[model samples]
Target chain A: MNILEIKDLHVSVGGEQILKGLNLSVEQGSVHAIMGPNGSGKSTLANVLAGKPGYVIDRGEIHFDGDLLNDVDPEVRARAGLFLAFQYPVEIPGVSNMEFLKAAVDSLAAARGGEQTTAVEFVKSVRKIATALDLNPEFLKRGVNEGFSGGERKRNEILQLLLLNPRLAVLDETDSGLDIDAMQTVADGINRFRDAHNCVLLITHYQRLLNHVVPDVVHVLSDGVIVKSGEKDLAVTLEERGYAWLTD
Target chain B: MADRLEDSFAESLIANLDSSSGSWLAVEEIIDRLKSSLTPAATKESWKYTPLRDFLVGFTGAAAVTPDITGVNQPGLTMSALSAAGEYARGPAALANTGPLPLADAALLCAGDAVHIKVSGEIAQPLEISYGEGVQVPIVITLEDNASLQLIERNNAVEFCNHSLFVELNRGSRLNHARSALDSNCCDWGLTQVRLLETTDYRLQQYHTGARKRRAETLILLDGRGARAELTGAYVVESNSHLDQQFIVEHRSPDTFSRQTFHGIGAGKGTIVFNGRIHIHPDSPGSDASLVNKNLALHPEATINTKPELEIYTDDVKCAHGATVGQLAEDSIFYLRSRGLSRDDARTLLCRAFLKSCIEGVLAEEVTEALLRNLTGP
Candidate 1:
C-alpha cells in the first residue's frame, strides 16, 4: 500500500523558491533513497514533509496515510507515524534525554489509544534499543544532545527512530556526521525498524550509506523535481558517473 | 521631579510615624537613615539602571503595615524543598550574627519576623511561607551553632502592593531560602534585604513573574572568617509589565566567597533590569566572588538593561562579573520547530530550559512543578 505521496509540491524559504515541483511515492515496507548534488532541495523536502514553518507551500498536495497533510501540525504528523531524523539535532539544555524520549513515546502512544508506559517499563524497553545502538546507559541521564560528539548525536537520532517506531521514517542526512562504526550502527537500527508495516525515506547526498542499507528504489532530485528514478543499481551508477547524464 | 517624589515619600513616612512604641522609634530611625544616606535625586552610580525617580514617585504613601497572616494555612512541603534547606545549613551557616546594623533599613527592624530556630546541628524540616495580596512582610531568622534550616517563601500579590523582607544569619549557621513571586501586578514596589555573619553561609533563590511594576533588592554583608554566599534568580515578564533586581554583596573579612547569577525573559512590551555589584574590602584578602546576568528578549519591543560590577580593594581576591542581552537562538528555535512542535511550543520549551538552570537545585518537587506549570502555562 502507498504510505506517502507528494505531487507537484513547490516550497519557498525567505521568499525564494527551493522545491519547484517535487514528486515522489513510497509503498509500505520499502526503502526509498533521494540523492543529488548540493542545493537540490533534499533537506527542504524533509522539512516540508515535517511541516516546518517558513517553507511557504505555494502549490501541491501531500498525502500521508490517506490524509491531506498541508494543515496538520508537525506533532500530529509525527503521531500519525511520520518521523524526521534531523541532520543537526538540537541540544536542549536542562531537559534530560530520558525525559524527552519518554514524552515523545507517550505522545505517540496516546495518539494510537495505547496505555501510557510506566517508568520501569519505559526504562526496560528503551534499554534494549540503547544497547543495540551501542549507546551508553548514562547518555540517557544527560541533557538532550548537549555536548555530544558527532557520532553520538547520530546514534541518538537512530535510537529515537527505534523507540518511536514510526510508520514512515524520514532519515535526513542521518549519516552525514557519523564515522564508519557509527554509520553501521545507525544502518543496523534502521534495518531493525524496517518491517512489513512501515517504510523508510533516506535523504542524502552521498551513496556511502546505501552500501550498508540498500534502497529498494532510488530517486535523484534536481531543481525540486525527481529527474531520474530506478532500482538500487541507480545509486551505484550515480555515485560513479555523477549527475552529468541528468543535465543532458 | 525625582527630588519632589523623594521628598514627598520621605515626608509621608515621617508624618505617619506612630509615637507610642519602641518599634515606632525603629521606624523613625529607618526614615532618618534613608534621608541622610540617600541623596534624593543624586543619580548615584549604583542607581543608574533603575528609574529611581519613577519608583520614588509611587512611594509617596507611608509604609503600610502588612496584615497579620493568622488565618492562612502553611503551604505543604516536598523532599526537594527539604534538601535545599539541608544544603544551606551544611555550607553557609557557620558564621556569627552581630545583631542588626545601625544604618540598615529601619522598617525591617519594626516589621520583620525574627524567628529563633535551633537546627539541632542539621536541618530537620522544610520551612514554607505563603503571602497573598496587600501583604508587606519582613522576616529575620538566626540559625544556632552547627544548625541548618531550609526556608521557602512563596509570594502571591493581587493588588497595588509592597512586600519587604530582611534576613540575618549567624556564625556556624546556614540558611537556604527560596522565594517565588507569581502575583506581581498587584504591587508597585517590593524589596528584600539579607545579611550574613562571619563564617556564616547564605543561599537564596528567587523566581518572579506577573507584575505590572516590581523591584527587588538583595544586600549581603559577609563580616566573619570563611563566610560564603550564593544568590540565584530567574524572572519572566510579560504584557506591558516591568521588573528590576538590584543586588549588593560586601566582603568585610578574609576568606569570604560569594556568587550571584540572575536570568530574565521579557515578552510583549515588558522591560527588565538587573544591577549586581560585588565589593571586596581591603581586609577581605583571599576573597572569591563572581556575578553573571543574562537576559532573553522574545519580542521586538521588549527591553532589558543588565549591569554587573565588581569593586575590589583587596588585590589578592578573585572576582569576575559579566552581562548579556539577546533573543532566543535562531538555530535552537528552528531545530525545535522542525521537530513538528508549533512555534509557541518550541518557544515555551526553550524558555523553560533557560529558567530551569536557576531553580533545579530546589528541594521541593511540588514547588518546582508548580513553578514550571506557571511558567509553561496550561
Candidate 2:
C-alpha cells in the first residue's frame, strides 16, 4: 500500500521556486532513495514534507496515510507518524536530550491516545538505542546535540528516528558528514528500523550509503522534479556517470 | 525645577530618618551627594537606560515595614537592629565608591532602623528574610574569619519597596546569597553591596519577575587577594513591565576572580535592560573576570537592551564579556515541532532552556517555578 503520494507538487521559498511539478510515491514496507546534486531541491523536498515555515507549497497534493498533508502543522504531521531526521541537528544548549526525548514521546503518545511510557521503560529504550548507535548513554544528560561532532549528530538523529518510531521516516543527508564506521553504524540503525509496517525515504548525494541500506527504488531529482526512477542499481549508475548526463 | 524637586525629596528622606534615629552622621556624606547630584538620568551613562528621574518625579515614598527574619536563632549568628548597632553599620554606607547612583544611600537614610546580622562560624541552617508591602529597609551582614552563611532574601507581594543590603566577608569567609524579587505590578528599587576579604568566597543567585518600575543594582568588591565572587541571575518581564539591572564587580586586589552570568526574557510588550560592568584596578594584576548577559525577546513588541562593559587598567589581567539580545531560533522551534511538540510547547521549552543557565539550584527552585507558572503567552 502506498504510504505517501505526492502529485504535481510545487514548492517555493522566499518567492523563488525550488521544487516544481514533482510527483512521487513511496509504498509501505519499502525504502526509496533520492539522489541529487547540490541545489537539486532534495533538502527542500525534505523540509516541505516536514511543513517547515517559509517553504510555500505553491501547488501540490500530498497524501500521507490517506490524509491530506497540505497546510498541515508540523506537529500534526509528526503525530500522524511522519518524522524528519535533520541534516544538521540543532544544538539546544540547555534543553537536555533526555528531557526533549521524553517530551516528544509523551506528546506523540498523548496525541495517539495511548498510555504514556513510564520513566523506566523510556530510559531503558533510549539507552538501548544509544548503545546500538555507538552513542554514549551520557549524551542523554547533555543538551540536545550540544557540542556533538558531525558524525555524532547524524547518529543522534537516527537514534531519534528509532525512538520516535514513526510510520514514515525522512532522512535528509544524514550520511553527509560521517566516517566509514559511523556511516556503517547509521546504516545498520536504518536497516534495523525498517519493517513491513512502515517505510523509509532516504535522501542523499552519494551512492555510498545505498551500499549498506540498499533502497528498493532509486529516484534522481534534478532542477526541481524527479527525472528518473529505477531499481537500486540506478544509484550506482548515477554515482559513476555523474548527474550531468541526466541534467543535460 | 527638577533638581529642586529631587533635593526636596532627599531632604524629606533625611528628615524622616533624623527624627527617628539621630545617627545621620554616618550617611550624611551620601545624602549630601544625593542632594547635589540628583540630575536627570538621561545624561548619565550608568542610569541612561533607566528613567529614574521620571519615576521619582511623581513618586511619593512608601511607608516602612520591617522585614520578617528567620533561621537566625542558630548558634554563631547574631541579629540586631541598625539603630542599636550604630557604629557597626557605619562603614558599609560610607564605602568609598557606591557607584554613580544615590539610590542606595537614600534607602539607607530613609530606613529608620535596618537589620544587622553577624556570623562568627559556619551556620548550617540558611537564613531567610522576607520583605512585606511598602518596605524600605537596609540590611547589614558581617561574617568573621572562616565563617560561612547561606542568606536568602525574598520580596513578598511588595507594592512599593526599597531595599539596600550590605555584606562584609572577612578573611576565609564564605557567603552564599540567594535573592528573589518576584512581585509584579509594583515599584521596587534594590541595592546589594558586598566586600570580600582575603580568601573569602561569595556566590549570588538572583531571580526576578519584572514590575511596573523596577531597578536592581549590585556592587561587589573583591578587596583581598585570592578572593572569589560568582553572581548569577535570571529575570522574566511580562507585558508593560520594566526591569533594569545594573551590576559592577570590582577586582581591587591581585589574583581576585569574578564571574557574572545573567539571562532575561522579555515577554509581550515589556522592557528589559541589563548593564554588566567589570573593573580591574591597576594594582590588581592576575585578575580573572568575565560577564555574560543574554536576553530573549519572546514577542515582536518586547524591548531588550543589554550591555557588557569592561575596564581593565592592568595589562596582565584576563577579562571576557559578552551581551546578546535575540529571539528564539526559528530553526530550533521547527526542530522541536518536528519532534511532535506544538508551537507553544516548543517556544516554552526553548525559553525554559535559555533561562536554565541562571535558574538552577535548590535556592532558586521555588521562585523559578513561580516565574515559569506565571509566564504569559507571548
Off by over 4 Å in 2: B14-34, B37-43, B53-63, B84-101
* For every candidate, C-alpha RMSD to the true structure in Å: 6.3, 2.5
Sort candidate 2 into its docking category.
high
Query: After superposition on all CA atoms, how large is the RMSD of candidate 1?
Result: 6.3
| lDDT tens digits by residue: candidate 2, B223-287 | 99999999998889988888988888889999999999998888878888888888898899999
How do all models score by TM-score? 0.84, 0.94
Model 1 TM-score? Answer: 0.84
Cα lDDT, model 1, residue A247: 71
Residue lDDT tens for model 1, B1-378: 546645455556456544232332234445554665445333555456455544443332334355333212223211111111211211222121111121123333333332222334565556666555542434334466656767777666566545555555667778887877776464545555555677888898887774666767677778788988999878777766777777778888999999998777876677787888787889889999999888888878878888787788988899999899888876666555444455676677677777777764464354454444544443
**Residue A151 deviation, candidate 2, in Å?**
1.7
Q: Write the per-residue lDDT of candidate 1 for residues A1-248, one digit (tens) a residue.
A: 89999989999999989999888899998999999989989999998888876778999999999889987877788889899898988788877788777767777777889998999999998888899999998899999898999888889889898888889999999989888888899999999889989999999888999998999999999988899999999999999999979978
